[model samples]
Target: MKAMLPESVRATGADILLGNTYHLMLRPTAERIARLGGLHGFMNWDRPILTDSGGFQVMSLADLRKLTEEGVSFKSHIDGSKHMLSPERSMEIQRLLGSDIVMCFDECPALPAERAQIAESMRLSMRWAQRSRDAFGDRPGHALFGIQQGGLEQDLRAESAEALRGIGFDGYAIGGLAVGEGQEAMFGCLDYAPDQLPSDKPRYLMGVGKPDDIVGAVKRGVDMMDCVLPSRSGRTGQAWTRRGPVAIKNARHADDPRPLDETCTCPACTGYSRAYLHHVFRAGEMISGMLLTWHNLHYFQELMSGMRAAIASGTFEAWEAEFHAQRALGDIERV
Candidate 1:
């Protein structure tokens, strides 16, 4: 994945990529990576990398995890080794990794919980945000971003945003949605959630979704987002295009001579046909993943570039209309 950075990512105009604090800490250990000259040297990619604070992973991936006022303690899923992640520790780890963008350590409560429970969780996250800020101190070029967490409650979201603003951060992330909240409910929260943050700073939507989800979020004023959808979906034989998803594993593509998308200039579309992609995917060839992942990443960057250009030229609405209209066409009517 790191090897693909130059052509597949940077060439396509993506300047930043997200790194998982939890997974990195577990595998090579922060100390090892730092000893080897930090993440850039370790990964051989000099671009900006945003590191999450490990709070969400502790809640989701760790085994026998225990949350407390100070932090959380858990056993690693890789091994039964014990570990702890507090706001201070999280800050230290990101600093050790030499991340360009460090996220504040904050609790993310799963949705469908009672309003009272969500409120309590959001309040706790606010306190942690302050601690994260304090622990982060002053890094010359590096930035620390605060996270706003409040289920779907508008009042709670406003309150959380106020708390983050009071503490102050280089950027703000709207968290706690996309856990299980459907797109409509998530968009409803976004309607007011992003507006609550400082408009001057970048507004990042964490774990935000598909092409449509990204389009909607950008339209609603979110400046940054991160998700595993494109890469993961590509590995699973799913391709995202202007016309929507195309499942390459489906029988319909087995003998199709056309490219995945006629307008796409990526290697997948330019060098291979739908039939070749389907054959390789069905045969479990590794290139199947590489080509598809490249195409997906290229497509996402194209989408971002289009949005940025549209917004700069004061024609975002027209660009967005075309985006949806293309999707409405629906994958070239099944080949």
Candidate 2:
């Protein structure tokens, strides 16, 4: 919704929205949003909204951030204002934002770290998870989710999951992956991580990825995922389609009159041609981003719908085979 209209996002069949607690809290202030009737009212989005607990942003984006047993203290990137985000504070912020699904405040360490570091971070996050749960208290409608943060260590992951389960939550998120971890490493972890959590509750893979990554995560038992790739790529003149990723700014599209994808029914494909898209992108028109973003989100939702149907019908193996085969064909042969 930040890059495009909520109506446009809804048109793409996105049932839920993810809001950044760090951004909203720092800029607009969570208190201000509460007066404006929370994020759903402020953003005019009535659907489910999941708000991360601001742990990742503070750890990665904040200037001169310091991590401690209590919480993280840092200067905001926006104004360099001093702030602290403990588990209790994170819970309070999410409540003020009126988030339907809230993630526990948990530390996510960078990958390629020593096992000891990973273990230490995971233990700290587990403690924070319990604190987050306690602070969240009894919100009747809002659901708090516990985040698992064990980096890539299987034993640590199991331990983290066990901790979260003991504390209890509405859902479980597999965090600490996708933080500089390559697909192979991530996939290796996913092979067992999802299973470690309870099968009854929702299993979310946070900050997950492209089309193939989504497919792989789903196949490995992930129930939900969220990413900025589609919208981000859209703004950068890229589009994701059934065939594969398409660079819309390429000169090859200067004269071609084909749609980004012949099979796509998005506004970008059905109503505009590659030449037009390329022209708008090169011309630096704002509609360029909107069109591509709409197309990418549409394609992603379609892919998920396809997978859901295939899974229901017990034909996922065949569906997966065909999905790869389609991408292998690449974009249409030279316009």
TM-score each candidate: 0.97, 0.98
Model 1 residue runs over 4 Å out of place are 2-7, 333-335
Number of the top TM-score candidate: 2
| Clashes, model 2 | 0
Best-fitting candidate, scored by lDDT: 2
Return the clash pairs for model 1, or none: none
- Please state the error at residue 89 of candidate 1 in Å: 0.6
- TM for candidate 1 is 0.97
Candidate 2: C-alpha lDDT:
0.93
List the lowest-lDDT window of 10 residues for candidate 2: 55-64
Relative to the unseen true structure, what is the C-alpha lDDT of residue 96 in candidate 1, on a scale of 0 to 100?
A: 92
Residue 35 alpha-carbon offset, candidate 1, angstroms: 0.3
Residue range 1-335, candidate 1, lDDT tens digits: 53265546666667887889999999999989999999988986788999999988898853479989999999998888999899999999999999999999999988888999999999999999999999999899999999998899999999999999999999999999899989999999999999999999999999988999999999898999999888898899999999999999999898899989999999899999999999999999989998898888889989989999999999999999999999999987442
